[model samples]
Target: IDEFWDYDEADRLKAIEISHAYRKSRGRSRR
Candidate 1:
């Protein structure tokens, strides 16, 4: 159960990072 929890946490963080990167790219394009 602990391993699953860790996996989920990592996945969530990775998803957030990807979203952040995408947002930054879009903002840069506006310039």
Candidate 2:
């Protein structure tokens, strides 16, 4: 259970980072 939760947390963080980078790139394109 602990290992599963750890993976979930890591994946969530990774997804958030990807989304942030994507948003930054998109914002530049709109400018």
TM for every model, in the order presented, reads: 0.85, 0.88
For 1-31, candidate 1 gives per-residue lDDT tens digits of 9999999999999999999999999999987
Error of 2 at 11 (Å): 0.3
Best by lDDT: 2
Candidate 2 C-alpha lDDT tens digits along 1-31:
9999999999999999999999999999998
- Report, for all candidates in order, the number of backbone clashes: 0, 0
**Model 2 — which ten-residue stretch has the worst lDDT?**
22-31
Candidate 1 wrong stretches, greater than 4 Å: none
Q: Give the number of the best model, judged by TM-score.
A: 2
lDDT at position 11, candidate 2: 100
lDDT of 2: 0.99
